[model samples]
Target: MERDALLQVANFSTLFACMVLKFPQILVLMRARSTAGVSLNSLVLELAGFIVFVSYQMYYDYPPPTYLEYPILIAQDVILLLLILHYNGNMKQSIFYAAVFIGGWKLLTVEKRVIDLAMSLCTFISASSKLAQLQCLWATKDSSRVSALSWGLATYTCLARIYTTVVMTGDVQVLVRFVAMTILNFWVTATAMYYKPSAKKKD
Candidate 1:
């Protein structure tokens, strides 16, 4: 009973965190009316990784609770992506991105090997997404419109999933992904906080 309770807590905590994972970034962008310090490449790559991971989970018929947060995360990412593109005056490119994502989704599960391959590379893909954001911060040295809160929340979700995945799934792919994501998310949070304009101004 205790184990089950912990699993429930972890799953629900991850879900709740993911539900608002991108909201801070989205709000920051909208309020600032700019995509400054935000990385479009990072958002696109992150969205792609989310799609692949969720598709793999669904393809394998894993427990819903283990990955229920992904759809919410995906939806939030889509909204965030659109906002970035709109602010950057690249709204027209959204159609192309949407089409590619949809097509890739269909193809990923067409065969077991395909999904497995994607899962194998998922950690790197997801890590690249974080690295892309880090590169952005490095280039600008300003996290004006980047939300450290969102990245911190992401770190929490990934850590929660590290617990839940071990408890519920025992799937190595899922476990590795969560582990890698936990580290990267924390790194992003730290980097964003470091580059935050307010922090710089106070210095």
Candidate 2:
């Protein structure tokens, strides 16, 4: 009973966090009218990761609670991607990217092996996304527009998902993904904070 209660809390918390996971970033971009410190590659790769993960969960009939947040996260990512493209004055490319992402989503579940392969690569895809963001921060050396709050919230969601994954699914692949995400999210959060103009000003 206690374990079940904990799982519920963790699952709901993760869901809630994911619902607004990208809002801070989105708002920052809108207010600043720039994509200065954000990585378009990271958003694209992260969207791919979300699609594969949710597809894997659905293919295997995993518990809805375990992966429910993914769809919401994907939607938020789409909005973020559109906003990024708009700010970059490359909105015309949105159609091509959407077609590719949609086609990739459908192809992932055409065969059991295909999804398995995709899931196997999901961690790397997701990790690469975070690394891309890190590279953006490193290149810009200014995270004033990066939304550390978004990354910090992402870290929390990943941590919550880790607990929920263990208690609910016990799927090694999912567990590994969450663990790696948690570390990367934390790294991004710290990096963003470290690069803040205020931090530099204080130094």
Candidate 3:
């Protein structure tokens, strides 16, 4: 196969892996109806980041993301929003409004600078969320509450980011995000190993 063909195949496989892991994590959250141990701050930041990232893609005329990526991310964000509202006993009208405003602005605007600014903002939000998650794990000394599926997703995301970084010069931001996520994943996984839930306690 030609070099471009090989790159395409790799990208497809990585995208598929990301979708597989991400969807399962969303399903787990939905079925559990409990963000009990999950970090709300992280979720909020992630939603913010995703909004920017998606907008960037749209503005830059990047190829359409896989169908699975869009739906899974939407589902995850919606679920997180609902969980926050329910737990805090606060209607998230403002959050919804903000999402709408930003999304609309991106859709209506044509300037490349505006899109670049959005991407930069989104990247910061994403980093903040990841850092918040790490802090949560460290403070509690318990990674048991984090969804296992998220860890799996991180692993695949790391692999995919590394591949993309090597193949595509424009993907540096994504590569950095994935690298940070991968490191956090290892930390959480190690903490989880030490704090496994006890079967006897459950009974």
Candidate 4:
């Protein structure tokens, strides 16, 4: 019982940390009032991945923590996505994206196998989106809009969660996914470093 309690605490702590992780990113965007180094598509894809994972957990009737993580993650990303759109004068575009996201969410909620496949595919797609974001950062060599601290913390949190996951479930696929996400997070961090100075000069 004691060991289980400890594990539960660890699990919740990790999830909660991840849930609140985007706050720093949000702050970065709000303060700068710019989406210069950020990618709206990347946020959209991440939101999709979060939705699919949450749906998968719901389909299985997984633990509350699993289901709860969805809304928490969604709440953060929605704000980020909206902020990105608003700053980029793409708020009208968000309406269409939201419609499509809602429709996709509805479609995915219907079946178990579909949810499973989506979770898998969304994970890969989200990783790819992040990679694309990384490429953008490198090409522009300007990560002024990127929150290095937030990405660094997120990367560390994923690494910690990956350790906890391996210790708790020993699930190969989940481990692989976590590993993949961590690498992307690291890439995000590196992008920030690649463009260290705060004030980016226009060429």
TM-score for each predicted model, relative to the true structure: 0.97, 0.98, 0.72, 0.86
Tens-place lDDT digits, model 3, residues 164-201:
55666456665676676667666655554455454113
Candidate 1 Cα deviation (angstroms), residue 117: 0.5
lDDT of candidate 2 over 129-159, digit per residue (tens)? 9999999999999898899999999999999
What are the runs in model 1 whose C-alpha is more than 4 Å off? 201-203
Better of 1 and 4 by TM-score: 1
Off by over 4 Å in 4: 1-6, 167-171, 198-203
Q: Would you list the C-alpha lDDT of every candidate in the order shown?
A: 0.90, 0.93, 0.62, 0.77
Kindly list the per-residue Cα lDDT of model 4 for residues 1-203, writing each as its tens digit.
88677667767776777777889889989999998878777787788877876776677665665345568878889989989989988789888988988998999977777777787796697697788778778777778778788788778766765766666656465677778989999988877876867554457
Ranking by TM-score: 2, 1, 4, 3
- The TM-score that candidate 3 achieves is 0.72
| TM-score, candidate number 1 | 0.97
Q: lDDT, candidate 4, residue 144? A: 74
Candidate 3 weakest ten by summed lDDT: 194-203
Using lDDT as the measure, the top candidate is 2
Residue 22 local lDDT, model 3 = 52
Model 2, residue 148: distance off in Å is 0.9
Any idea how many clashes model 1 has?
A: 0
Superposition error at 137 for model 1 (Å): 0.3
- TM-score of model 4 vs. true structure: 0.86
